[model samples]
Target: MEIEPYVDTTLDEPLVPEPPEPGSILSESVIDELNMTVWTLSNGVTVWLKPTDFKEDEIALQATSPGGWSNSSLEDHQSAVIAAGLVQQGGVGAFSTIDLQKALAGKAVQVSPSIDQNTEGMSGSASPEDLETMLQLVWLYFTSPRQDETAFQAFMAQGRAVLENLGSNPMAAFADTFSVTMAQGHPRSRPLSVAILDEIDLETGVDFYRERFADASDFTFVFVGAIDLDIMRPLAEQYLGSLPRIERVDSHVDLDIDPPDAHIQKTVRAGVEPQSQTIMAFSGPFDYTAQNRVGMRVMAQALEIRLRERMREDLGGTYGVGVTGGYEQIPEESYTVTVAFGSDPLRSEELRGVVFEELRKLQVEGPSQEDVDKVVEGERRARETNVRLNPYWAAQLIGAKASGQDPRFLLDTTTIDAVTIESIQEDARRYLNEDRVVIVTLLPAEMIGRP
Candidate 1:
């Protein structure tokens, strides 16, 4: 499949669209305690503006809306993944990929579209002076997404080459196996393979992109950092307000992907290296709430500290350990806590036993005051730093609104401070059930002798 050759279409003068009248599209702006302004645009696109001197000449912009992979069927999942990458490679409107690069030359502006489990949107940063250019690019993406067969084939060829030997790599195989195990045979959880890539149609992927981004009304645009409302309003009206609006109210559809109910243990023998990787996952249906989410995070941190001490220092078994906990909002609201480590294949079982012991200890004795204090202080410092940044606010506001929570929740720190040892212990007791755990181990073929 040969791609269309790039042709130079440079002209003596570049065409630029005229800005719309700012006064025509009125907005209702509400100033919050954190000095952020929430503006509801006439076209139903909500805009969150936080003017700051954090950076002298830069601003961050994020536009997000729900209905991502949730909008895709089992057969179309691979297309959804390829379409996001194709959008950037295919360029925007009439500009070829190289031509688009030439058009953006010498400008510190970047914008890219992406899709996840529950949302799809674009995010980018630009200099204050180049805000119009940023909005223009965004407008082009939503209005005229180019479908270049050449770019699509090229991207697929590159992806195929990379994935050709992916299964031969032990870590990659483990990751694939782990995903399937956690998802319990859900169609969306299937690992990417050459067979799956072969099924992707360039035209179908492009059409999927168009269908997902068809309605711009549901999107909320968040802009933060060195911004003046007077300068931003016109650009917002011209590019965002002028977007094609449809009477469509779209949200993600739950596909009902859930973890296995009973405990599972799987061991994979691969690669030639003399090492083993182990993952212990505990998950269950959880009520999605602000306080519960905070408690899970705090519990993960406390557990991480204890794991590092026992696994790395005391036993000298592994170089390091990783622990993470989070709740997913789609399918059904559920939380997972995972602890993973790499160690000698011969001692894999022993090290895993120690990890379980620590969990049992946390359940029985609970974390100490010192452990709670360390996590709280670390969280406080992180919150203080993130509050001053634009990307942080952009992500926070988008997530809050999508989950039907108040944007003001970003400003509330009561939950973080309220996390006590008792609360974390209670959460641990409820979530970390031995009967519901999933343990997966990957060992070298030589160490475990393939059956």
Candidate 2:
């Protein structure tokens, strides 16, 4: 469908609501160690305040909840994706996207909502003077999200254009194949296709987004940067506290999206270049503790060092390689470690063998003290830098609260010190099971004897 060009002149002026008055604060406390304050608002919404002088005039805002695609049904997947995309595209409250832009022309503020596999949240930054404007925008998103059909159609048109020739891209095809295989063919795991784009309903999409963001009581708002609690408390009470509250206590349900339990290998022949991409993935359930999470990171860093030495430096099979470890609290607390790289098709299998060899070595002999020290030092430096940034604190606070963890865990730097080489080796043995691995190799058509 061809969408009519949106003309700003014909649209009516947007109805901007007045800023809410400061509401009553029920309770407040400070964590002396972290230098942060936690406030329980009269409306039951928790607000975290961390005053920092890192950016003299900037403040970061994050509003998070535990419900996301996990709160959506399989049938609503397409709608949910479209809804989240179009929600901000169409604008909030009575403002059209164009008008909203005009309204905030001089303000240094940004706010957008997102729905992930297991979480939904909004993140943006604003100048200290524009904090009330930021709160007002947040209130609008929660209370009144305008659905413009024209914006939805335009978004879908752009999306379809991007997906029209996606199959022609060999790397894209390989990524889709890898996702499908790893997700065990779960419907939600399927990559977006042109057909799925046509299946999305605008009304359904809007409703799905609204349902997930309906209740404000379950939401936790975190604000960080150069701001005073005395001044912020009243603004938070008026704008955030005045949001409509509902009694819904929805949380993400585990959809049982697990990787295959047995060893599985898949090879795809595509593209014309004489290159092959390989992903060596190992995944399983894990205890979602701070200590365990740190242990997994240590293992990934150590494994990357070994792979670089064997695969890139010694054998010269690939230019570079990467090892990534991820832990998810929802869907039953699990961890996945993926080793990915690209190389000549002829040497791909040889490099793949080396990947396993490194894992086996870690399982038996464990990472060297030198390797462990390198990872620990790198982590320490990163943590030290992150603690001084407002964006980092915002993310950490929201994540910790959503996952039912102590916010002090973010301030605790001792976990890295406690991650011993033995713990990393144990993690390797427990998580790197050969039977539970999924290997995907994408080779050139010529290499696989295909036209």
Candidate 3:
């Protein structure tokens, strides 16, 4: 048999099979203030349901629970980190990769499971008509994950090809060193390399994945879209409620991943292209709360405006600049703020001086009233739009749940509406303290007299 790339476009028919039916569920409680419904299955799974008419035929779901690579034992640590990616490559349940594709030839549905530093779960979407197939896939993923050796070897081979001659790209050298330095010698923080391939095996990766998703008691599944509470209840209970349930207390383990304690600086040289880049990072311990999180967001937005003004507009040194800073709640309560941009190697020193000058201004005086107002206005508009979207609600609830943050904060707009100059300055001083800072400069390789 030969493969055919052409489709039979002349046929007036859909190749898709029939969709699955909905399930029944009982509501535990309804919070009118949040306009949300909650249900607890007999098997210990929690479901958060919010109905919306945003899209006529769309729904988004995010199921999450505590425990990630951070919770793995030393023997399974490396495998756990890449477990989600590897497991997904192999087909789920009783379907081979090709068989699964053939089965889902014309369906608008997708589901992916992933494990990060502090969380593991499923993220997927489907039309209301196909919700049953979506849930069916979910149940199969947890109960019967396939361990196909052929798929595993193929994934490994692809990995080797990607890692081979990776250093040929200049950014590769700079990025590798930057990651190792930020990890501060934490064994688990090492970047993926060829050696990692040897340390991790197919069976170990699949085994770790099973252990992470084995228990559904701690997981919270949020469904938002055009939903009929009456129609979805039974389907959710049948597929999701039936997932493996075990009695266990699970949480992310602290591997002591810390940034440099003192101010440190390093320079990297790579590639032949005439380009250079610089990154300035600052981090320290701080109060992790909703109000503080909003405040930090405001400060970062304002700082970016000022940097864009000076680095690109005033000096005309680079094309653009970016500032990213936020507080972490899981495994540790800490903050990190970083500013980076590209410039000529000769002017790198001059531009370096400018970066610190801006830093000093932000630390002492904060952005202008106009800048603060601009940031708040933009944020208000974004929130206004975000609150109406389903994905926004799904991400907010699941992320807050995973990080141990207060989900009630999702409805609070007082902080964003009441942002002041003094508050921005205070947040800057508190989180971006100078004690913990790492600066890295990336310059082009040698070239003496090229005109």
Candidate 4:
């Protein structure tokens, strides 16, 4: 029997479906269990501990150092971030990565580093039996960061390989272009450039670790889960107390947020996926504002719904669309709403226009009662769910308190219950003005150098 030939016609069919957005109405009981304890060490290390009363076989630990790109040079910041990846690769004191692995072998201890634009730190989890060794490892990375040049170059080479392959990824290109356009000339603007990577000589790595990167004064230690203040205090005093007090350099540069004179389209074509991406950035007020934060949360939820309905359901553009606010605390605190969607380059202009029109509608006419209620309900549910799923929510709250932001915002029933619809409309009116927005379009490189 001969099988019939098949012709693929699915491409011509509309792909996205209009599904009811999940959990539109939030419940109240999820908000009750938010609790935490904060302990301040004599040496200035703030610790946040939240115990799991039911008793898990293992424990997780996480600590964050708040001073990120705002506190260091682009090159040094990159070096410090990248160094976190390389720290265990070399070794500390007398141990190599291999030796350290062998030491922790068969034990429930694991350590890793996480670096971000505004923070750099390490985290680990261990069995109650191995907590001391876990903390010791943490101390090693913070105190003696072994910046071996050979290992760093090898790591950089691997990074270059990954970057070269990212040439084809539409999302990666969008991210690259967005960083350049939004943060140009600012410390936040700089990504690891080829030129900078090329200049990473042996001395660069050594000086980065020994001098500017891991200063004790810029560090904050946070421990969560099954920790005793008395037992850990001496260990902390010994491991962390020895850190020298040194004045570190600050990395801040001035940049403007006003919309560009003309809308611009940029491209990075040398990649595997030659698709186009659009990034819609609108002015958002500083995040610390109670009104703005509440407004921003509601507005973001409203925008997410708008994008889902308009782009995914109405236009059938892509599988997903995301909108997030870029809230920075240093290098001058500011805010921006970045929305990106995946699509063909030919439709880039249409996508941009539709997004702007949506923004205009929000500015000219306030969201409907239904839209406002839906967002408020969605955000309230989200905040409540987070408090329940992660016990570390308490640590995060306490950390915010340690940094001077009131943690009460999380637990304050008055604050959560008091978010008014008028407050949402007021923020939209104040910050969503088109004059303050920047529209950036990034397309494939082949499509570029043509128009």
Per-prediction TM-score: 0.94, 0.94, 0.92, 0.76
Q: Which stretches of candidate 4 lie over 4 Å from their true place?
A: 1-42, 52-55, 58-60, 64-81, 113-120, 166-174, 185-193, 212-219, 241-275, 284-287, 389-391, 398-403, 444-451
Predicted candidate 2 versus true structure: per-residue lDDT over 8-52, tens digit per residue: 563355334456655677998998877889888877788888899
Q: Which pairs clash inside model 2?
A: 21-238, 22-238, 23-237, 23-238
**Model 1 poorest 10 in a row by lDDT:** 11-20
Model 4 lDDT per residue over 336-431, tens place: 776778777777777777777776677667677788878777767887766543335635653564346765565654554555555655666665
Please tell me which model should have the higher TM-score, number 1 or number 3: 1
lDDT of each: 0.83, 0.85, 0.81, 0.58
Question: Across residues 1-451, which tens digit of lDDT does each residue of candidate 3 receive?
Answer: 8998986333222222332332335448886776788898766788988888888788899999888888888777888888988777777765766667776767878888889888899999988988887888888778777778898788888888888768477787787778788888677767677887678887888899999989987889998898887778778877877777888999888888888888888888787777888888888876887888888888888888988999899999989889888678878888888988998877777887887788679889988999999999989999989988888988898887787666777888898876898888887777666667888888888744423
Residue 351 miss distance in model 3 (angstroms): 1.5
Q: Which number leads on lDDT?
A: 2
lDDT of 1: 0.83
Model 3 alpha-carbon miss at residue 241, Å: 1.4
TM-score, prediction 4: 0.76
Clash pairs, model 3 backbone: 23-233, 23-234, 23-235, 24-233, 24-234, 25-233, 25-234
Runs in model 2 deviating more than 4 A are 1-15, 20-22, 448-451
Error of 2 at 163 (Å): 0.9
Off by over 4 Å in 3: 1-27, 447-451
